[model samples]
Every structure is written in C-alpha cells, then in structure tokens.
Target: MQQNLDYQHLKAQIKNWALEIGFQQAGISDVNLNEAGKHLNNWLQKQYHGDMEYMARHGEKRYIPKQLIPDTLSIISVRLDYMPAHLTPYESLTIQSNKAAISRYALGRDYHKVIRSKLKKLAQKITEEIGDFGHRVFTDSAPVMEKAIAEKAGLGWIGKHSNLLNSKAGSYFFLGEIYTDLPLEPDQKQGFHCGSCTQCIQDCPTDAIVAPFQVDARRCISYLTIENKGPIPVEFRQAIGNRIYGCDDCQVVCPWNKFTHTTHELDFQPRNDLDDIQLLELFNWTENEFLNKTQGSPIRRIGYEAWQRNLAVGIGNIKTNEKTKQKIIATLKAKLDESSDLVKEHINWALNQFQ
Candidate 1:
C-alpha cells in the first residue's frame, strides 16, 4: 500500500485521468482567487454585468470556494474543446451579414449538460481512487469563480477578450471545475502572453469593450439578445451587425485562433444546418419548427418570441434588394396575423426597413 499520499503524484494521475475522461487539460490549485474577486467587486460596483444582479449577491463567497464549500483544499479545473469543425463560423457571418450569428459555443447541445455529465464521471473516478472524498462538481453554477480558479490552476491566463486562453489549445474551450478536499499540489500559474495586442478591443462590432479587460454587457450583443427581455434599443441595433444570440467578433479576430483545433465532440456540431441558415429561412421557422429545431440546444432557452425578435433585427440589417426586401416584408406581415404584441412590434420595425 502507498504509505505517503504524494500530492504531486496524485495531481499528475488526475491530469491523465481527466484527459482520458475527455478534458483537454486538467489542473490543480489551492483555494484562492482574491485578485479576480477584486475585479468582480469593481465590475459589480460599476454595473458592467447589466441585469445580472446575481453577480453582486454572492459577495466574497463567489471567489472563496472554501467559504462556500467547507474544507475545500483544492480546485480541479478542466477544459474541453467546443469549436466544431467544417461550420466556417467567420465565412457564414461575413457572407450572410444579415443572418443571425449565434455564438459558436451554443450551436450544439447545451454545454452545461454536456460538461456536467463529464464532471460527474470525473468526480466518480476520484471517489473510486481516493474513497469517498468531499467534493462538488460545477459547470457554470452560481458563486464559483471558475475562470479565476482555472487560471490559478495553470489552465491559461485570462485573455484581453476575458476568456481563458490555452497556449496549445487556443481559447475555444469550455471550463468546468471540481471542488475537493483532496490536497493536490498546485500547478504553476500560466503567465499572460497577450503582449501589446488590442485586436479583440478593436474588433468588437458594438464597441462593448469599453477598456482593457472591461466589458460593458449592456452594449454587448450577446447580453442584449439572450439576457435582456425587451425591445433592443435603436442606438445599438445597427451596430449589432448580423449577430443575434452572441457575438464572436472578439474571438474571431484573435491571433491565437490561428492555432485552434477543431472539436471532435459531436454534441458541439451545428444542428439543423445552423451554420449557413439564411436570415429569411430562420425568420420563417414556425413556432413548432423553432421548438423542434432548437430542442436540447442552447438556443431553445431564448424561446420563440425572442427568437423572432432577433431574426427581425437580422432581417432589418440585410442589404436592401428587390427579392430580399420583399421576403422580409412578407415574413413580417405573416407574423402580424398571429404574433404577440412584442413580436409584432419587432416585425413592424423590420417591415419599415424595406420601406
């Protein structure tokens, strides 16, 4: 029997186990994310997260895993690739400039479910080896500074785009965490390699990046489309370009993406040809079609009315042409007959684009 528990040795074994369990990388870190806590506090004070009031409610518990989970000695951070291949995210966004550009991450099955399932399996494996440990698995659950913990665990430094960047894997991965009492040796923190690049700041179509490392979620297309429940204000709608659900402009222009590898995870691939689907075609999806097509996908969470509203904005943004203009008007009129008042308002606004 192994007499001394080699924390370092256990860490290495866990890393190997995580890789075998579909994680791109695994890292261990002691429970401290104070720097990120300050950032979160400052961001909350400035209301940068918009209507996400939960960001402010957790206080220090959000950063201190031990405070939330007693005796949390270590955090196990894991990354999984999510960029699906052969979908051509940039080309579709550029060519069909009026089409809705859902963030590449949400094109597939709900990542929360996928990552949670993997994390559950990882936790079970640890229980098998170490015999019933104090642990909680998290994939974007409340009060967890996942990115901060991951960065501290040496997964990658936070990029200017405010996403984790792996030197070998790029920034196109989802992060999940396991909080455990196991005293695994910490990994050396990854140093920031961003240098002097500001491409992500410059490439933001809606100018959401107000400063270096500061994102105003209010102006962010992703937040406006997915989180805020109301008419998208006129001021930023034109700047929103073709993006509907979430904007990937920052990531698209990042130099690091050149080294990006395609994900083999089938759940991440575009479903129902979401890749190149036209704005008019998507706008024409019946409520039933919308429900069925987006079932089990992240887009389903936005529901039908918001889906149509986003599509209406996309339709309005399209280049004015005879057939395209006619189609937009025709779609708007169809909605008028059966749409709820909120959807009708968006439909009328889109119809006005052709006039």
Candidate 2:
C-alpha cells in the first residue's frame, strides 16, 4: 500500500519534471486500447495506409502495450510545439508556383532525433527518482498509435483532421511517449470540441480527408511526396502544386492553429532557407549538393531520386512566361542523360506540361 502511495506521488512529479524538461504538457494513461485496435483494423482493411506496410506489420502488438513491453501498466505522453518563429507564411508559399512549399515540420531538423532524445532524458529522470523502472520511449519512430495514445492520455482530443488538437495549444505540436511499468493515475480524457467545423476537410489540396475523421493516405500529398518512392501519380500531379516536400494545407487552414505557439527550441528553426526556397533552385541541386543540404533534415530520407522527382512535379506546376518556360526546359534537358529512369520519367512528364 505504501508502494502504491509512492507511485501516485511519483506520477505527479513526472508531469512536473516533463514540463521542466521543455515538454509543453504531459499526461498519464492506462494501457488499454481495444477501441483504437478496432479502428486500426478497419483502416487497414480499407487500405487507407497506402504503401506504408509497417502500419500493418505490427498486428495487435501496437494496441496491446504489454505485448510490445511486458508488464507495462501505464503510458506518459508529452507534447512539444514545433512551429518555428518568424518564417514565411504557409499560404504565401503555396501561391508562389516557383517557390517550394516544404512542410513547416521538415523545414527544421529531423524531429525523430529531437523528440526521441528528449524522451530519453525524461525516462532517465524517472529512473533517478525511482532508482530504476522499465520504460521504452518513442517519438514517431515506432509502430506507436501516438495520436490515439496521446488523446487517451488527455493531451487533446483527435480533431477532424485527425491530428491531436489541444484547445489551448492547438495542433502545431509534436507528441512523444514513455511506455512504462509505473501504475500512475490516468488522466481524464478530454472531450471533442471540433463542434461543426470543416475547415481542414475543405482546404485539403488533394481532398485526402474523405470524411470528417478519415484521411486516405494515397490521396495525401504529404505521403505522396515523402513516403512514396515511385513517380508521383499523374492524376494528382496537377493538384500537388508547388509542395515539394510534405503538405500542411490541412493544418494551415485549421482555425485552432491561430492559437498555436511558436517553439522556443532553436533546433526547430528552419535550415538552408527551406522555409522559402524556389523550386528551380532546389531542382538545380546536384545529387551531392542534395545530400549535403539535407544532411540532418528529415527531407534527406526521401533520397536524391525522390528529391528530383518531387521537384520535377513542383516545377511542372509552375506558372511562367514562354521565355522563362524555355529557360526551365533548357535546365531540365541538361539532366536528361544523367537522371535515373524513374526521375527521367517524371522530368519527361514535367517537360510535357510546358507544351
């Protein structure tokens, strides 16, 4: 009974320590996700995950926390806002056909590394207090139902766009989790407050949000530009506009994002002017230049081939005069003999857009 009391006290301390460690908020939740499991199975059955096979690979292990880490009793979920201060607005970048609209999240360093390191520190702090405890930390790196877990932890309710929405903090934040054996008191789940708003669904460039809470990944520009390795689908190419990296139209249009706070972490600040670079300039990057520029950025994972492929799509969507179009055509023609067949195909498609 004394041990139980100590754990209850420890839970309160964990939340305080989390805030001290730079997390915006933290909450605890018990390890039961039966309803989330059912929803996962249904989404997988509908093939909404697109080519991300890993989402299906975890089976029931994802929802059953004990299966992933035996003897786990609760989870501590933390939120960190990642929106950078003093950057080009998302709407302005989208309208500039020549400018590359990289997602706000990727404009800075890779979040997987940043969030994972912070979660590790939080775990170590817990160890310092309790002697030792079984815990596994995750950012977006694992097969974790992060949003579902975070929502259950009372960080926020899942908004209509499917991102976690805190009434006070908004949706422009990152989530990390610490799965542990501690029997912490679970937080009360926050009620949904989306009301009748449909801004996110209406503003999606590709109409990826097929329903109020359903997003089809195949139609999502973020998935197409980032996760997909093949050529961007011809059908969606025109709709993609100049978004060379991930898309943020849904979040940008979310009314709640008006209350979003700028991140104090310097690590999330934009690198290499990614927040406002032109498509032609990014397209002009040689393979070596691509590697060097994206070294620590999440954009590096897409590789040089996909980088050029996405740029080709972005450039093709550019609205320019015949003289400038000719200049663009000349630049693309120079890479014809050197580009890989897949990239060449996209380039060829891009060249056709001029005609």
Candidate 3:
C-alpha cells in the first residue's frame, strides 16, 4: 500500500515536471491497447498505408507496450503545441497557386528531435528522483500508435481526421511517450466529441478521409508528397494543389483548431520562409541548395529528389501568365538532363500542365 501511494505521488510529480519541461500536457495510461490493435489490423488489411511498409512491419508489438518493453506498466504521454505564431495563414497560402503550403507542424527544425530531447530530459528527472528505472522514450520515430496512445492517455480523442484533438488545445501538437516499469495510476480517457461533423472529410483535397476515423494514406496529400518515393499518380496531381510538403486542410477545417494557441518555442518558427514560399523559387533550387535550405528540418528527410517531385507537382498546378509559364517550362527543361526517371516523369507532367 505504501508503494502504491508512492507511485500515485510520483505520477502527480511527473505531470508537474512535464509542464515545467515545456510540454503542454501530460497523462499516464496503463498499457492495454487491444481496441487500438484491432483498428490497426483493419486499417492495414485495407492497404491504406501505401508504401509505408513500416506501419505493417511491427505487427502486434506496436499495440502491446509490455511486449515491446517487458515489465512496462504505465506510459507517460506528453503533448507539445507546434503551431508557429504570426505566419501567413494556411488558408491564404493554399489558395495562392504560386506559394507552397508546407504543413504548419513542419515549418521549422525537425519535431522528432525537439520532442525526443525533451522526453529524455523528463525521464532523466524521473531517474534523479527515484533512482535508475527501466524506461524508453518515443516520438514519431517508432511504430507506436501515437494518436491511439495519446487518446487513451487522456490527452485527447482521435478525431475523424485521425489526429488527436484536444478540446482546449486543438490538434496542432506533437505527442511523445515514455514507456516505463513504474506502476503509475492511469488517467481517465477523454470521450469522443466529433459528433456529426464531417468538415474534415469534405475539406480533404484528395478524399483521403474515406470515412469517419479512417484515412487512406494512398490518397493523402501528406503521404503522397512526403512518404511516396516514386512517380505520383496523374489522378491526384491537380487536387494536391500547392502543398509541396504535407497537407493541413483537414486540421485547418476542424472547428476545434480555432482555439489553438500559437507555440512559443522558437525552434518551431518558420525557416527559409517555408510557410509561404513560391513554387517556382523552390523548383529552381539545385540539389546543394535544397540540402542547405532544408538542413535540420523534417522536410530534409524526404530528400532532394522527392522535394523536386513535390515542387514539380505544385508548379504544374499554378495558374500564371505566359511569361511566367515560359519561365517555369524553361526551368523544368533545364533539370531534365540531370533528373532521374522518376523526377523526369514528374517534370514532364509539370511541363505538360502549361499546354
């Protein structure tokens, strides 16, 4: 009974320390993700994951925390808001065909590094208090069901858009987890509050949200622009619009996001004017320029080739004057000799858009 009381006190302390360490919210959850496992199997069975085979590689280990880390009894889930303040509004950028609409969360340094570093510090603090303990920290780097775990941890509900939605903070945040052997008392999960809203479904440019609480990654612009490596299908090119990195239409359309607080983290501030840059300017970048610009940013993970491919798609969808059209066409033609077959194909498609 004394040990139980100790754990309860530790849980409260953990939450307090999490806020001090820059996390907006933190909650504990016992590791029983059976329902989430079922949902994963169903989503994978439908092949909605596209070429992200890593999603299917982990099998049951993703949902079974103890199986992944033996003796794990509780998980500490933390939320950090990532929306940078005072940038060009997302809706305004999306409508400007010449401007690239990079997702709000990825405008700055890689969030995986930021959140992972903070989580390790939280774990270190725990160690300082209770001595050494078995614990593992995870950001989006692993195959963890982050949204599901966050929902179960009482951070928020998994909304119809498949992003965690908090009534107070909205969905523009990152989630990190610390799986531990500590027997902390779990917080109560939040109730689902999406109700009859289908705004996210209607707003998706590619109809990626096939149904409430389900998204087909093959049709998701974020997956197409970031995760996909090959030539983009001709069908979805126009709908992709000017989003050169990832899509944010669903989150932007969600009513809850109106309550979102801009992040104070300077690391999340826009770099290279990514939040509102021109497609033509990005398309003209040489490989070295791409590397130099995207260094230390999450956009770098997709590499230069995919970056060009996405920019080509965005440029193709631009509505411009004859002079601008010729300039874009000349740029596309100049890269033809250097581009790989995949990029060449996209460039050709982009050039054809002017005709």
Which runs of model 1 end up more than 4 angstroms from their true locations? 1-4
Where model 3 places Cα greater than 4 Å from the true spot, the runs are 1-5
Q: Which one wins on lDDT?
A: 3
- The C-alpha local distance difference test score for the whole of candidate 2 amounts to 0.91
The order of the candidates by TM-score, greatest first, is 3, 2, 1
Q: What pairs collide in candidate 1?
A: none
- Score candidate 3 by lDDT: 0.92
Candidate 2 regions with alpha-carbon error over 4 angstroms: 1-5
* Candidate 1 lDDT, 1-355, residue by residue in tens: 2346777777888898899989889999788788999999888888999988778888889988878998899999999999998876664575567666778998999999999999999988877776787889999976898888899999998998788888887888999999998888888999998899999999888888888888999888889899878888878877776787887888888888887889999999989878766778888899999999999998999999998888888877788679767866877797787888887887777778777
Ranking by lDDT: 3, 2, 1
Worst 10 residues of 3 by lDDT: 1-10
Error of 1 at 17 (Å): 0.6
Whole-model Cα lDDT of every candidate shown, in order? 0.85, 0.91, 0.92
For candidate 1, report its TM-score.
Answer: 0.96
lDDT of 3 by residue, 133-211 (tens): 8899999877678888888889999999999999999999999999998888889999998999999999899999999
Candidate 2 residue pairs in clash (backbone atoms < 3 Å)? none
Q: How many residue pairs in model 1 have overlapping backbones? A: 0
